[model samples]
Every structure is written in C-alpha cells, then in structure tokens.
Target: MKVLHVITGLGVGGAEQQLRLLLRHLPARCEVVTLTHPGPVADGLRADGVPVVHLGMTGNRDLSALPRLTRLVRAGRYDLVHTHLYRACLYGRLAARLAGVRAVVATEHSLGETQTEGRPLTAGVRALYLAGERLGSTTVAVSPTVAARLRRWGVPASRIEVVPNGIDLARFRFDPVRRHRTRRRLGLPDDAFVVGGIGRLVPGKRFDVLVRALARLPGDCRLLLVGGGPDEHVLRREARRAGVADRVLLTGERPGLPDGSPGPDLPSLACAMDVLASPSPEEAFGLAAVEGLASGLPVLYAACPALEDLPPHTAPAARRVPCGDEEFGRALAEVRAAGPGPRTAPEAARHYCITRSAARLMDVYATALARQSLSPAPQGVSSA
Candidate 1:
C-alpha cells in the first residue's frame, strides 16, 4: 500500500531518526513530509531512496499548512497517512481527514508526565491533542510508559497501540577494530574510560550531572556527548566550572543509523565507549540506553521504560540511578572500578530489533485500514 508520513521536522532528534529507521523496514511504498528543518536525518532518508518533501511550516500556529498538506495528501491518493511527533499529529490528522484519507495513524513518540516532546504539558495542549486524536484511526505509543501517559490524558485505552522504538542490532554490534578506529579518530585514548551520554543536550536531559560526575572521576574518564542542542554552551560552561572541560567531548548531532555520514556513526561511537549513562529524569522509551545495550556497553539510566518494562534479568549490565550528580557519579565510579567486562549484547537488545518493530507496525497499519473500511467517513469527508 502507498503510505505518507508527516512529521514536525527532520532534525537529528529521536523521533525524526525513528521515522527514518521505520521507513527503511516498512513493506509499503512510503513517502515523507517534514513541516520544517530538513536537516541531516532528511538527507539520510533521501540517501536511503525515500521521497521527502518539506512543508515549510513557519511556526506552531501556521493555519496555511493545513490546506497545503491536505492538497498534498489528496493528490497522493495514499492508502494510509501516518503522523509522528506532536505538531504533525495535530496537523496531519486534520489534513488527512480533510483530504478524505480515513486510514490515519499517529505515533506518540514522546510523552512524559510533565511534557510532550519536550514541550510543557498545558491544558491547551491536552485539549488540542485529544481533538486531533479523534480524527485519526489509531495512536501508536512507543512504549507502555507513553501509552499510560496517553490514557492518563483521557485518551481511550482501546485506541492506543504499543510499538516500541527499535534499532538495527547488527549496526550497533561491538567490534574491537571499529572501537579502536573510532577512538583514534575522535582522539580518545585507548585506555580512557569513555562515558557516553547520547541524546539532545537539553536541561531536561540533565547532562550537566554527567559533567559533574566526570569531575569526581579520574582524569582518564572522558564524557562523550553524542547529540547537539541549544544546551551545548550550557553544558560546556558546566564542564568548565566543574573542571572537566578538557575531558568532555561533544560530537554534535550524529546520525541515529549508519547512512554513510562522513565521520564515525553512532554505532562506532557506541563501540568506543566503555559505558553509557543517561541522567535524564524522564524518558519516553530510553532509546539511547537500548542502543548502548545493543553495543554491549553497560548502561546506567535514570529513567528507561524500555529496560524497566523488561524483566530485570534480561539486561544484567544495565542499572538505574537517580538523576543527581553525586548519585550518577557513584554509579560511574562503580562501573569504572569493575573494569570493562565482556562486551556482549544482552537478550534485551534482541527484543527491540528493528525487524520486530516493523512487523508490529505493519500489523497496526493493516488494522487501521480494516477499521477505516468498516466505519463511515466523517460527515463532510468525501473519498476524494
């Protein structure tokens, strides 16, 4: 079937990268439209031979985007319209309905107790979300944690589908040669205790805790932050203030999957690291932590429903720590003292392979199409 995916933007964020990965594995013919910021991920998607169109949405309240998107949807004659992220869900749902595509599915990629995709949750957000939700056939949550959050926001449980974000396990597998090459390219010493913190460098991510934790560790302990954001300078200043600036390396946003970007991809960086630490107090699925697990790196996370939802025995190398500097610092030290054990991916990684997620998503798509066939179109929504 022909499918169209609409998203808020195509930046190197978790949701954007997740969409890119999903498009590669989904069986149907798929195209994408990004409202704004067609960045690295967009280029990667194109390289992977997917058609990507930028909708040029100015801001949050751009009403003009709705009609434009509607026209595009109608012209495509898509069998299904899948929307990702918050802004896309709101606009894509309405546009799909206006364009007469009843088989619409929206994925809740980021939903926390206090935020939705890093934006503060307000009364208006809830109202608009619910309003848009009604226009779609189904809402797919990345994890049970996000599904619970959606239910708490008054969305019916029957409408929420749990399809966790997935990873290409082969790409993230540990390789000693790759580890050495990546470390040399990034100027990391062979024996350095590399502590990785992968994600947007935002306040909510609490990466500053890692900087402080670095200060408490030996000089050889390095903090390599994988992604970029507005908080880069803030984290730099924190590193300087904490006297770990020399030890912290921020490789601005890298590709989530290996799409032949210039420098070492995230998988290589993962192999170079000794441990992965996520200090973020709230997370939707904890994708970074799972990627670390795939790379066979010991993971320390403040919040990871992906791991927590699984049986504890599945991920023996992963541990949870509070999002405080001292607490994370102690965890880091404890990991370092133990030395790097065998770098082997745990059973948890296999549970989140991209193929499994793609199969499950196809099921969601088929079910959505079936439901749309049985239900009557909204009053004025003609099958144009």
Candidate 2:
C-alpha cells in the first residue's frame, strides 16, 4: 500500500523520531512521503531508498503548497496519508481529502493545549486544529494521556486511537566498552558523576532548571545537554548566569537520521550519565526518559501526567521532580545517591522498540481500512 507520512519538521524531536522508526520498519511494499522541515530526516529517508517530497513549506498556512500536495497525492493514488504533529495533521489531511485518498490518519504527539514558551496557540488556533482533525479517518495519540487530552478537547472518540511511540533496540542497545571510550574521549574524569539530558533546547524543556539544580549538587557532578534548537543560545546564557557553564556541555546537533546512524551511539552517550534528568514541565511521551532507562540509568522526570505512566521498566527506574529548582535538586540527589537497578538495555528495549511499536501501528492502519469499508463517510464531508 502507498502510505505518505507527514510531519511538522524533521528536527530532532519525539515526533520525528517516532516517524523515523515507523518508516524504517514499514513493509517493503509501502511507500512514504514527507512534508515539513525536510532536512536531516529527508536525507536519511533517501539513504534508505525511500522517496520523500519536501514541498518547501515555510509554515502551516502554505496554501500554495496545498494544490501541489493534492496533485501529488492524487497522482500517487495513495491508500493512506498518515500525519504526525499539528501542522502536518491540519494541512496534510486536508490535502489528502482533496486528492480523494480513502484514509487519512493523524498521531497527536503532544497535548493540544500545552504551550512551550513563546509557542502557545490561542483558543482560536486550537479550535481550528480540532476542526481540521475531525476530517481524519483515524486519529492516534502516542500515549493514553495524549489520547484522553484530545477527547477532553472534543475530538470525536470514534476516530481516536492510542498508539505508543517506539525505538530501535539495536541502535539504542547498551555497550559497556563504547560507553567507556566515549567518556574518555570527552575527558570526563573517571570519578566524576554525569547527569545527562537529551531534548530540543527549548524553553519548555527546562534545561535551565537542570543547570540550576546541578549547582545545588556536589561540585563533582556535571551536566550533558544533548540535541539542538532555537533556544540553545538562551539556555547557554542561563547556564552562564547560574555559574554552571563550565559544567554544562551542549552537544549541538548530531548526525543520525530516521535512516542515518542512530545519532551518536547510544552506549557512548549513555555511559556519560549516572542519571538522566528531564526537567520539562510537559511531555507527551518521554522518549528520552525511556532511552535513559534502556541505558540502565535512573531518570528524574518532572512530575507530570504525561510522564507518570512510563512503560513498565521505566516507571520503576525513574523518579519525578516538581518543577521548582529545589524540588528538582532534591529529586536529582535522591536518585543519584540510589543507584539504578539491574535493568539492562535489552530488558528496557522490550518496552519501546520500534519494531514492536510498528506492528501495533499496522494493526491500527488495517483496522481503519476495515472500518472505512463498512461505514458511510461523515455527512457534509467534501473532497473539494
């Protein structure tokens, strides 16, 4: 079947990672198309022999691209168009309908109302999002929290499905030797403790809070902030202001793709941390937290509903910290003093493997097709 996957961007974020994993494992007969910030992920898809169309979309309201996207979908005769993130969900699904696609599916990657600093949507925008998604043949959420949130916001229950995100076990598998080498290469002292975090350097990620909390810890403790985004400079300044600049390492952007290498080796990165810190006040599904757990490290995640129901291995392996600096510091110290359990990478991989998650997604896709065949299209729905 021809399946087109749409996303807001190919940036280093949870939704991108989820789409990457799905594309990698999708059946060979399936075809994929991407429309968003077609950067690294697009390159990676081509590397895997998957065809990707960028569309040069500058923002969500790129009406000019609509005709192009509609034409492409119609020409491809795609059986399904599965969209990830808000922008693609809005634009891609609409375009898919215009092209006479039988199925349009969307995965809600974040809570609809939650705003990450400077990016909160007004009530009007949120309403528009809800209205657009109503056109989707199926709506998916990466976690139950996200699914429930959409329902609460008035998304039709009949169209919503909850599907958790998945990771690649082989890529994220633990490697003791690689971890040792990576630590040595970074010049980390054998005796020093590393508290690591991986996420977009955004205001909502609260990396500044992690930096401040590190100041409260013993001097022997250091911080590693991985990934990149617009807020990198803002976060760097905050670290300097908090007097922990030297202790914080921003690894910038790394080379790896949904089809490229799995962003520097997980073992090497995981070895640099005694504990993984997540200070974000909101998370739809904590991929970083799960990755930390897969690496056999304890995670200190913010006390938020999105993170509270981490998969089996993760729930036991992570501790939750309140958003305040003092609470974060206390949570960090407590997790640090107590070591991680005997969970190995292989053990943790079972809960979030991309292969496992893909199978579940396939079931969702097939179910949508079956339901569509049996039911009439909602009244007043127009392909135009």
Candidate 3:
C-alpha cells in the first residue's frame, strides 16, 4: 500500500527518527510526505532512497498549502495519510479528507506540553485538535499512557490505538570494537564514567538539571551532551555556574538526527557509556533510553507515565531520579558506582525493534482499512 507520512518538520527528534526507521525498514510499499521544508532528516531519508515531499510550510497554521496538499495526495493516489505531531496531524487529515483518501491516521508523538514555535489563536486550537483526532479514521498513541491521555480528553477509546515507538536494533546494538574506537575518537577518558544525553537542547529536556546533577557527582565523571537548539547558550552558562565546566563535554550539537547517526561509531558511543540520562519530566516514549539499553548501558530517566510500556528490566536498569538535580545527583552517583550490569541487549532489541513496529503498524493499517471497507461510509465521508 502507498502510505504518505506527514510530520511538522524533518528535524532530529523521536518522531522524526521513528519516521526514518519506518521508511528505511518498512516494506518497499511505504512512502513519506513531510509538511515542513526538508531539513537534515530529509538527507538521511534520501540517502536511504525514501521519497520525501516538502510542503514548504513557513508558519504555523499555514492553510495556504491545504489545496496543494490535497493535490499531492490525489496525485499520488495514496492508500493512507498518516501524520505525526500536532500541526501535521491537523493539516494532513484535512487534506486527506479533501482528497478522498481511504484512511486518515495520526500518531500522537508528544503530549504537546511545550512549543517549539507557533502560537495558538485561542482555546479553540486544543478543541480543534481533539476534534481532528476524533474525525480521523484512527488515532495512534506511541504508548498506552498517551492512549489513556487521549481517552481522558474524550477521544473514543475505540478510535485510539496504542502503537509504541520503535528503534532499529541493528543500528543501535552494542558493538565492542566501535565502543572502544568511539570513546577514543570522542577523546573521553577510559577511566572516567561517561553519562551521555541526546536530545534537542530545549527546556523540556532539562539539560540544566543534568548539569546540576553533574555538579554533585565526582570530578572523575563526565557528561557528554549531543544536539543543539535554543537552550545551548543557557545550558553552557549553567554548566559554568554549576562549577562543573571541566567535568562536562558539551558537543553543542552533533550531525544527523536524534539517537545519533546510523554510523559505525554511533553504537559504540552508546555502548561505551556507563549511563545514559534523560531528565525530561514529560517524556511520551523514550527512544534514547531504549537505545542505551540496547547498547548494553544502563538508563536513567525522570519518572513519567508514558514509560510504563518499557520492559521491567529497563526500569530496573534505570534509576528513576526525581525532577530535581540533588535527587538526580544522588541517584546518578549510586548507579555509576555500581556500574551498568549484565547487558540486556537481546531483551531491549525484542521490545523496540523497528521491524516489529512496522509489522504492527501494517496490522493497524490493514484492520482500519478492512473495517472502513466493510462498514458503510459516514453520512458525509468518502473512500479513496
């Protein structure tokens, strides 16, 4: 089936990373469409030979391209219009409906607590987003926690499906040779325990808290921060103020996408780490933590409801630090002293393999299409 995926932008984030893996590993039949102008992610997708259509969206709520989006969907004769993130979800579904696509589906990537850009006009945007989810043929949440959130917000339980985010185990699995090589290449001390964080340098990610936690840890420990954004300068100054400047190695922002590149050294870099920390208070689903586990390193994260689907072993490996730096520091020290335990590489792979997620999504697509075919069209709805 021809599936066109619409997302806000092709930047490095969990949703964008998931999109790349799905296109790379999904059956040859799937295709993609990104609403925002092509960015770094487009380079990765194009490298993998996936077609990405750029909508050239300049501002939020840019309905100017709605007609063009409709034309594109109609021209492609897409079987399904699947969207990720809020803006694309809204615009993708509306365009699909206008183009008479068979099914319009949207994946709720994040809880929508923080904003990268764009301002909502009023309370109506939230209402409209909820309404859009309801009107769409199916709504997919990355985890059961998100699905529950949708139901709590009044989306019919029948309409919401839980399809967890997945990672490419092959790309992220532990590689011993690469581990030593990556550690050496990055110039990290072999004796020092490294705590790595990969995320957009945003307030929600709480890099400042990580810096504070590092302040409390011994001088021997080091923090490696990857990715760059609005929070870079603030976080740099935070490290200086915390008096942990020497202990922190801020890469500012590395190339490729979140979870690092699909490079030879990426897996090693992950596996070489003693611990990977995610201090975000509101994680919908953790791709980095899973990748860390897959790489044979322990993970530490702030307690978040969406993490319920992660395997019990992951939680055991992960020290659930509180939202504050003091608590985080204490927890980090404990985990680092003990060191990462037996590698649960196989277990992690089983839980988050992209191939498994693709098969599951295919099932969702097939089930939704079968139901739509068997049932009569809505009062005003039409088929592809």
Candidate 4:
C-alpha cells in the first residue's frame, strides 16, 4: 500500500523518530510531508530514501497551504494518510478529506491529563483538536494513558487504538566498549556515578527536579541533561541556585548519531551513565526510560505510562517515584544501592521493538481501510 505520513515538524523528537523507524519496517511505500520546519529528521529521512516535502507553513494562520497539501495528496494517490503530532493532525486530516482520501489515521504522541507539552489545555485548543479528530478514521494513541486522555477529551473509545512507542533494539543494546568510549568522549570521570536525563528542557520534563536530586547526592554523582530548548537558561539558573552547577552537565542537543544525524543515541548515552532518571511529571510513553532500560541501565521515573501498562514479567528495570526532589533523591539512592534491577532490561525492550509495533500498526491500517471501503464515500469533500 502507498502511505503518506504528515507531521508538524521533522525535528529529532520521539514522534518524528518513531515515524522514521516505523517506515523502515513497514511494507508499504511511504513518503512524508512536514507542515513547518523540515529539520534534521527530514535530512535523515531523505538519506534513508524517503521522499519528504516541506509545505513552508509560516505559522498557525497559514491556511493557504491547505490547497497545496491537498493537491500533493491527490497527486500521490496514496491509499492512506497518517498524521503525527498536533499541527499535522489538524491540517493533514482536513487536507486528506479535501483530497478525497477515505482512510486517514493519526498518532497521538504527546497528550496528557493536566497539560500538553507543558502548556495548559484551553477550551479553544480542545475544540480545535476535536474538529480535526472528526476528519480522521482512527487515532493511534502511543500508550494506554494517551488513549484514556483521548477518550476523556470526547474521542469515541472505539476510534482510539493503543500502540506503544518502540525502539530499534539492536541500536540500543548495551556495550561495554561503547560505554567507555562515550564516557571518554564526554570527558566524564571514569569513576563518576552518572545520572542522566534525556528530553527537551521543558518545564513539564521537570529537569529541575533531577538537578535538585543531584545536589542531594554525593560529590561523586553527576547529572547529565540532554536535549536543547528555550528552558536552558532557566535550568542553568536552577542548577546554580541548587549549588550543584559544577555537577550538572548540559550537553545541549547532541545528534542522535555521531555522524551529525537527527535522532538520539540514547543507547550509547545510557551506557555511559550508571543510571537514567526521568523525573518528568507527565509523559505519554517515556521513550527515554525504555531506551535506558534497553541499554541495561536502571531507570527511575516520576511517571511512565508505557512501563506501567506492560505485563509484570515483561516490564523493564524501572521504578516509579513520587514527583519531588526528596522522593527522587531517595529513589535514586535505593536504585544505586540495589544496583541495576534484573537483567530483564533487554527482554523488556524486545516486547516493544519497532518491527512488532509496525506489524500492529499495519493491522490498524488494514482495519481502517476495510471499514472505509464498506462505508459510502464521505460527503463534503470532492475528489480531486
């Protein structure tokens, strides 16, 4: 089948990376469209031979791109249009309908109960989201937590499918050689007890909490905050205020691979660290935590919807702690004392491999296509 994937931006984030990985395993002929900034991921996708189109949408008010996007969809003659993130879902769904595409699907990568990407949910945003959601055949929720949130937001339960985010296991496998090499490259002391947190430096990620926890730990312990964002100054101030500025290491935003590519080398980074800490109070799937586990590092998280949903036997080496500095400090101490929990980290990762996730997604796509075939063509949009 021919499929077109649409996203708000082609940045090195979870959803964008997931799409890049999913296309590798999916049997369908796939292409991509970025409604805004076609960042590094766009280059990586092109390097992988996937055609990517940048719609050059200047801002949220740019409705002029709708006709252009609809034309592209019609010309591609795609069997399905799959949307990811917020802006793409909103516009892609409408464009697909305008192109007379019967099967349109979306993946919800970052939605939570209290806020979305650290912003409060306003009534205007809710109405806009629901309006766009109505144009799609189904929405793929990355975790049970996201699925529940969609339902609470008035999306019919039947239209929501829970497909956990996945990783490429081979790329994330633990390696002693890589560990030493990465640590050396980062200039980390060979004997230091490193605690790492990976994600955008957003308020909701709670990197401040991790900094606080680091201050409470011994001098031998250090914190590595990965990824880049506008909150860098704020977090730096946080580290200084906590009196652990020296112990806090901000790597800015490292490329996913050493080749200057987009994505995350979380596996290698995880190997360099003794433990991984995800103190984010809200997360859809906690991809970083899962990757840390896959890399054979014990993970301490404030919230992990994906890990919590996993069967006990298949769960990774993760411990959920209350969201606070003291609680996280204590949890870190406990984890350091116990050492890396069972060697089941890799085993847990296998259950959420990209290959398995792609297969499940194919099933969802097939079901949506079949349903669309049976129903009369949707009205209000003419075929191009």
Q: Identify the candidate with maximal lDDT.
A: 1
- Local accuracy by lDDT, each model: 0.91, 0.74, 0.75, 0.85
Q: Model 3: which ten-residue window has the lowest total lDDT?
A: 112-121
Model 2: lowest-lDDT 10 consecutive positions: 257-266
RMSD of each: 1.7, 2.5, 3.0, 1.8
Task: Return the lDDT, model 4, position 302.
Answer: 88
How many clashes in each structure? 0, 1, 0, 1
Candidates by lDDT, descending order? 1, 4, 3, 2
Q: Model 3, 98-143: lDDT tens per residue?
A: 7877587888878634332234324676687876775478898887
TM-score of each: 0.97, 0.92, 0.91, 0.95
- Give residue 255's lDDT in candidate 1 (0 to 100): 55
Model number with the top TM-score: 1
Determine which window of 10 residues in candidate 4 has minimal summed lDDT: 253-262
Model 3 error, position 286 (Å): 1.6
- Ranking, TM-score, top scorer first: 1, 4, 2, 3
lDDT against true structure, model 3: 0.75
Candidate 4 contains a number of clashing pairs equal to: 1
lDDT string for model 4 (187-222, tens) is 889888889999888888888998999888889888
Q: Of models 3 and 4, which has the larger TM-score?
A: 4
Model 1 gets an lDDT of 0.91
